[model samples]
Target chain A: MNTVFFLVFGLIVVVCAINVVVQRHPISSAISLIGVMGSLAIIYLQLGAEFMAAAQIIVYTGAVMVLFIFVIMLLNAGSEEGGKGPLTVRLLGVPLLLVFLGLLSYLIQRLFSDTGPVRFGDFKGGSPADVGRALFSTYLLPFEITSVLILIAILGAIVLARKELD
Target chain B: MPAAVPLSWYLVLSAVLFSLGVAGFFFRRNIITMFMSIELMLNAVNLSFVAFSFQLKQVSGNIFAFFVMVVAAAEAAVGLAIILTVFKNRATLNVDRIDSMKY
Candidate 1:
């Protein structure tokens, strides 16, 4: 059951990830990346990073992806077709990518076949409470700093994107 | 009674995703799509962190991944804003056309 779920979600992630790269329209790619994030959230759950899984869905898929789609719509970006890129990327990239991935998979399978496989219920410490405790205790400073950083980002984005007034 | 997926499988998945992100970053023509590829690379690294955290039984990796996500959000905001400014000035999103700095 665990393997089956992993296979399904992993397949979804891989397919959507490829679609994210290969799609002609930025909007289509944006939507496909959302699919990747959704499936990745499930993979995170399986790995016992419950808090990260939730964050993946909420922060990443929800806020970040929405921001991406908004930009895509606002810009009125269209599908690109061989838009004067280097000849290598325009011609050889796709096939080379496939072969490179095949080699990588083969290498990884060869290297780590002895370790124990991932099993659910093996990890129990990924609860929200545990993450909160760590966040407030050991990582308190970085957490606070991140909030300030987010504030700065918001201000900068607003400043840069606002219209010029005469 | 399904078999457990090996730890290497997850790591391998991360590797593949990262490579795909790199491919997109190199191949795409639009700036937004390239930015999405950067996001993909970040996500792949986050996955690697979480997988290692599971392997080592430490929460530190998860914390790092969380930080990466936060930084990525900031990057996306500033980046998209810059893209908007560029579009307003130049009226084009194709990366090849925005080479005013290439003097």
Candidate 2:
């Protein structure tokens, strides 16, 4: 049952992610990326990290994807010739891509092959509460720094997007 | 009974997703798609984090996942904004054509 669910969710995410790349228009690509993120949040829920799942949906799907779409719409961003480019230049990446594919498969095999028994049980008492405790207690510094980083990002984005100071 | 799936399944799923992201990152011409590929890679890492968290029977992995989400959010906001600003100045978002930053 879990395997089936995992496969389905993973398939959904992979498919949408590919669509995000293949879609010519930026707006549609953003939309497809939202679907990918949404499926990932669902996978998080299945892992029993409820708070993480919620945060994934709220932050990635709700906040970030919308921001991406908004920027696309505001700029009216589009590709010349609906995404056509010089075939020679584009195909120049083919050999590099083949190299990447080789490296990826090697890494995947090396990582997953030596694994022991797949532990498929739940944490005895871990819950969202435990997550909060860890966030504030052990990982507090990084947590605080991440907030500051986000603030800087927001300000920087606004500054970049703003047309004029006056 | 809720069937138990192995950790390798998640790990393998993540690897596949990550590879797809890599392909998109290199092959795609559009900056937006490239950003989406980055997001895909991040989610792939999150999958591995969750799987390892479950394997280790610890809550720390979830914590890391949260942090990754925060960073991803910030990245999306800043990256997309930069793409937009670049488009405004150059009139096209093709990364090849926009080489103003090249030294």
Candidate 3:
């Protein structure tokens, strides 16, 4: 029953994700992206991670996607007309994708054959409390560095976006 | 109640989603769509991380997901701001045409 549940939602996410790329209009792509993220949140719920599922919906689908849509609207970006460039891009991508797929398949087979089952000894009973401790303790430096990186990205984005005053 | 699903199922789904995101990143022309594609890729990886954490019964995945959320937030704010500015100046947001900064 649960397998069926995951399979169905997973298929839906795949379809919507493809739509995110195939749609000609940016708004439609955003809509499809929302659908994809929402389904992913549902998958997280079925996996027994309520907090993650909520964050999936609230952060990505709710906040980030809305921001994307707002930018699209503000830009008034018109639907891309059928054009030669996109077609050429697609044509070039196909073979490269095939090569990557082959390489990834080989790597997966190699990893499983060599490693047997992964050892997850320390990962059991995962909880928000555990996450909090790990973040502030073992992973503290990485966390702080990531914060600094985000700050730099914000500052850089502002610099890039600022209009030159005449 | 039924046959148990293996952890590999979730991993496979994540891989598929990640690949689709990659395809979108390469194929899409609009900058916003490209950014959305990047977000998709990030979320797909997060799914795999959470799945592995679940299978291992650890909290590291949850913590990583939290960090990913922070980065995604920052990316959204900065990325959208840049997009808005590009549109205001160029009056277009197509990725191919924004080569003004290039020498």
True contacts kept of each: 0.70, 0.66, 0.49
Candidate maximizing lDDT:
1
The TM-score leader among the candidates is: 1
Docking model 3 quality class: acceptable
Predicted model with the maximum DockQ? 1
- Model 3 Cα lDDT, one tens digit per residue, A9-91: 99999999989988889999999999999999887766555567778888888888988888788777788755446666668
Report each candidate's C-alpha RMSD, comma-separated, in the order given.
1.9, 3.0, 3.7
**Comparing 1 and 3 on lDDT, the stronger one:** 1
Q: What is the lDDT, from 0 to 100, of the residue B23 in candidate 1?
A: 95
Q: Against the hidden reference, what TM-scores do the models get?
A: 0.93, 0.86, 0.83
Candidate 1 CAPRI category:
medium
DockQ for candidate 3, please give it.
0.49
> Candidate 2 on B1-103: residue-level lDDT in tens?
3355656767767877777787778666777778878988998898888777866778999888888888888888888878877887887767777776796
Candidates ranked by TM-score: 1, 2, 3
Q: Write the per-residue lDDT of candidate 2 for residues A82-145, one digit (tens) a residue.
A: 4555787477665766576577667766776665544323543236788989989999999999
- Interface RMSD for all numbered candidates: 1.8, 3.1, 3.8
lDDT per residue as tens, model 1, B1-103? 5488889889889989999998999888889999999999999999989888887778888888999999999999999999999999999888888997997
Which tens-of-lDDT digit does each residue in B8-93 have in candidate 3?
66776787788889988887778888888898899898888787667656677777877888888888888788788777878776
